[model samples]
Target chain A: MALTRDGPRSLGEAATGGTLRLAGYLLLGVMLMMFDHRNGWLPRLRGAAAMLVQPAWRLAATPGRLVEDARRQLASAAYLRRENARLRDNLLLANVRIARMQALVRQNRQLKRLLDAVQSLQMQGQLARVMDIDLDPFRRRMVINRGARQGVHVGQPVVDAHGVMGQVTEVLPDTAVVLLVTDPSSALPVVDARSGVRTLAYGAGRGDLLDLPDLPVTADVRVGDELLSSGLGGRFPAGFPVGRITALKPDASGSYLRAVARPLAHLDRSDHVLLLRDLAEPFGPPAPAPAAGPPAALLGPAAAGSAAHPAPALRHGAGA
Target chain B: MMRLDGQRVLFYLSLALAVLLLLLPLPAALRPLRPWWPALVLVYWVLEAPGRVGLATAFLTGLAADLLAGTLLGDQALRLTVVVFLALRFRARLRFFPMTQQALALLLLLANDALLRWLIRVVSGVPLPPPLAWAAPLAGAALWPFVFLLLDALRARLRLREP
Candidate 1:
């Protein structure tokens, strides 16, 4: 009976077809998986496919927009009036801050000129719009509207108004994915602005908090210490405000303290972000090079004065 | 009997529309409860025309779904193929069952899909919430009767013949 059933009866033939189809599907699945994992050809294919899907996405988003409009219409007139007044007050506060920032910029320019800066590094960046958030909650990834076509490249530092946000990880033709600093995978070298104590800050995956590891238990770090990019890691330019120490707790296991810092950037609120270009290099050991200049010429007066100011010690004490 | 060519085209078009619906930007609050529209449509087609809608077709549709959702490839394909295969294998018995019983079966099928998805996510180092994720199956089951009635009416109106 088994042999007869297995023989090429009409039903057996159909079953064989089913088996063949499954085999084909399995083969296709393996090929697709390999291509996607390798990411060489798949990204280009995905970009092309994205263009095809764009129209469908636009149509689907229409309903969401309509719903938003309807809700706004249903809102009470009194609520709109209150919102308007609140916006006006916020605008006034923002105007004051802008004026102060402009003055500070002018002062910094004059000071730099007086210091006789030689070959100053000037980086310019473009503003990009946030396209989508990661579907998986565990991944702190976001897609931006700008992509390779818009000069966005992988590893470019992205920032919001306040401070460093993250870096671009994947670049497509029309979109790029940014891994936010709040992601557990992200790490940045930061320094205390006042004291110049350099430390590495790692994201704890909490929305706005970063953790500084390996601080001495007796370290003079305190709450409210302003943290800025150390520029030790060439990924980010020096002096960009990163975060501020918000809490400190001594660990019982060792002589180290666990410090939590809140990011200066408003990760949830910012709609536009700047992708900084023209950073020297990323955090890596310096390459060996031939000495071409005198020690005094290499270590200029500005460098000597900066080293003389025990800013790191002062910052540690103030933070503590 | 309904003409197979026109019906096939209509089926594919509806499948496309269902996929688009799945891609729509739903409100955060409602997103969790968003119906697995593509899965439901796939199941309907598989059950109604098993000859045309087979494991391979199910897998391809699932692949499309994975691509649209930005999930790991083959994840949805595996689930969808399993679901369609089971439905096709039991179509004779399933078609005889009452709508409520059929709904219960659908609930079980959807639960299986969700369970597989959750396991895959866990294996991929993602955190999984508790059993509340199974709520979609219950919702899908409740919706089964209305979906069946609507699709059945359309089939009857079009004089569709079972494959």
Candidate 2:
């Protein structure tokens, strides 16, 4: 090493070597960025690296977990008792609602039979815990503690109680990355629940809002109307609540309307989330069978909402 | 040889700790205040142990960080490479600066990194990061003196144990 470095030509050689290496690294970095941006040619490599570094994420999350545990432990026993009683009462009320829902579902099936409409797929949701780490601030994404090992795959919808969240983008062995509805790259197909007018809602790069761009100026929409997933793209299941229109105004071009909305799901505060799997694609197209032949175990496409399993009644609409 | 082995161990441990600090979740209000942990540690190594950490080392550390953070794979790599290159290129003049001046220089370097980050975000079609993100360089600069002192104490103790 000394002989090579201490040579008379060392000064010139080192400068050239450093410059060449920097250029080569820069070139490689640009190529990598392109590949990653285009979502091409790097998933396998990233997945392998993610698997290897999974322990690091665990290590980083430990302190937050400990703090949460300590907070729970320090809570007064009286408070815990009150919380338990409240939960029990809520459960009883929910049970009554479920009983009513079951009857309604049975009646709906009879109507489907009368109309000879296709049987809808039943939704069974699995609860996944969200990881406590924040990702790139510019990107609305989060890590959930469920992955390929738990039957999670890319494009599965995630939702909390209040409304649509997002779909899985990358799945590792034990964790998956969920791109939230507010990511600029994300777009959700939504229908105005009152007017039945369908449009696409794009992420506005903010946590609380989504944008509906390029709407015809005379479209029927109001500031307070609720938006539900249209399920047109087969990615999100139809009828899941998305957000409520907050503002509607003319775009700069004046030929189209720009509508803004406030998402119904609690974007900032959520923990356990439900992952919805559309049995249609996984179970080879919904079986066209008699309505009486045991309720269909799956349904249309998947709609994802942000954070928490607060909407078990919606996602777990099976067992009816 | 034994001393060199100990130094390597210390270097790796310091890098790992910096990574852990970077990964720690900050509260929403405090997130913008997160210091550039890994880069600051990398600067220390490049300034003090030029033989050990070079461009390739910085790039690889960044790649690992990208994978762990689930960010664009080369984003951090490019940022770290530029930082290490500048630090190495200016090491002779930088090594002798007093604490205040050193931190001022560091502010410039970190600001360069922040610029690269903004460029990457725009070019990659991501929305502009919040304005608060620019404060991160200030946070890193504010913590520089303490980081330098702590790492210096650790390095000094390691050297003292050399027999």
Candidate 3:
């Protein structure tokens, strides 16, 4: 009776109900948007929701996993034979390289220790696995499986086998997000490996390119020149390959040249990255003091000048 | 009347099935081709059970999808709200249209949703690919008849009827 006989009355009620529902939905949307945008509420909620859905994701992923396993099984025999042959060839070559590299590494380590005593101290690092790519593809970011629980902190430099990948921007309980060098907001100080001329590389917002701006027309740069992190800004470690200059063209304004580089790290394919815990220092050892005081004859003039230029001595003392 | 209510229930169940299908671990290449399953499901439900499935239902379903897709919160909610409102407003005429015409209308509706989503992403400073992203709507439109038929079979099996 409630279903059949009351159709017209129910229809009238439904119209009013629909209007109320629309208003309610709009209010709910506004509330959720505000919560997500302003407060740090959504990440916790999202993490909890992700936990709840983990079982579902596992369930959904099972069939695909099984299919993959089956395919691998079917291909196992021939695949193993080919893989074994390749490994054998690589093993022979690697044996020779490893023997030479071992001596080189020992010498390098001794040199590094001597340098470390004179230079900045080295800090520990942790390895993390990339769990997910950013849902918003426009921004270049990856969420790593490691978080604060694993000692991952915001601002840690994330690197991969190829080079500097990015830095940890956000740390959650079980995950952290790395903002890649390809992200539009990212900038890194780099030097031309050939000429040692330092410049800033800015992300072009496009995933594939980094742009170097304000380079003078006479700047000694060319296509194929490797760029290394200069460690000038203290944000990244020195000597890590950042990118290779791939294109250079004079700007229409002609005052400067437009240059683009392809980042060395494979932004999309990397699954594991290292987070360097140590922060690099901004300024290196202060300019060495004048070897000795000015020559004796010049001393009088220098002493008179020193009294007038007390600021330089003050700066020198501050630097020490 | 009892039959019509049963049909409505069948519609909701079909939607749940569609959501499950959408969650299936599609190959990386096929992932983008995965049409807006929830959108199509909501469209079907709103066409059949406008009273039971209205703007609120659409908004809530969209919220669930946003969570599942890991997109910014309330994005799908806003899109679904607009979509369900349009579907409800046009339900009477939609029901009278032939399957081909209905599919065309669905295409237009999906295109509108895609445009709104693109606009929201742009406003939020997310760069989107060009008009090529609307490929999802074209695929969804092509699948509309198959989706309708599949739901019709399920409803018949469940002994559901129309009002």
Measured against the true two-chain complex, the DockQ scores of the candidates, in the order shown, are: 0.23, 0.47, 0.25
Cα lDDT of model 3 by residue, A207-228, tens digit? 4579898689999999999999
Q: iRMS value of model 1?
A: 7.9
The parts of candidate 3 lying over 4 Å away from their true place are: A1-24, A27-31, A38-41, A48-50, A53-68, A85-134, A137-160, A167-190, A197-216, A229-236, A250-256, A270-320, B1-34, B160-163
> Fnat of each prediction?
0.20, 0.55, 0.26
lDDT of 1 at B55: 83
Q: List the TM-score for candidate 2's chain B.
A: 0.95
Q: What is the lDDT of residue A47 in candidate 3?
A: 65
Which portions of model 2 miss their true places by more than 4 Å? Answer: A1-17, A279-320, B1-4
The candidate maximizing lDDT is 2
Cα deviation at A180, candidate 3, in Å, is 4.3
lDDT of 1 by residue, A117-160 (tens): 53234688899876533333334666677888989888899998
Which whole-number lDDT from 0 to 100 does residue A250 have in model 1?
81
The TM-scores of all predictions, comma-separated, are 0.69, 0.84, 0.71
A1-320 in candidate 2: lDDT tens per residue? Answer: 32222223333444667788998899999999898889654456767777576678778878878888898999999999999999999999999999999999899989989999764757779899878776765677878899899999999999998888899998889988898898888999889999999899999985458999978998999999999988777788888899999999999999999999988877667778889986322212554532232222333233233323424534445647
Per-residue lDDT for B22-95 in model 1, tens only? 66654444445556777788778766766567787888787777665555676667777777766766666787
lDDT of each model, Cα atoms only? 0.71, 0.81, 0.72
- Alpha-carbon error at A245 in model 3, in Å? 3.5
Q: Flag the better candidate by DockQ, 1 or 3.
A: 3
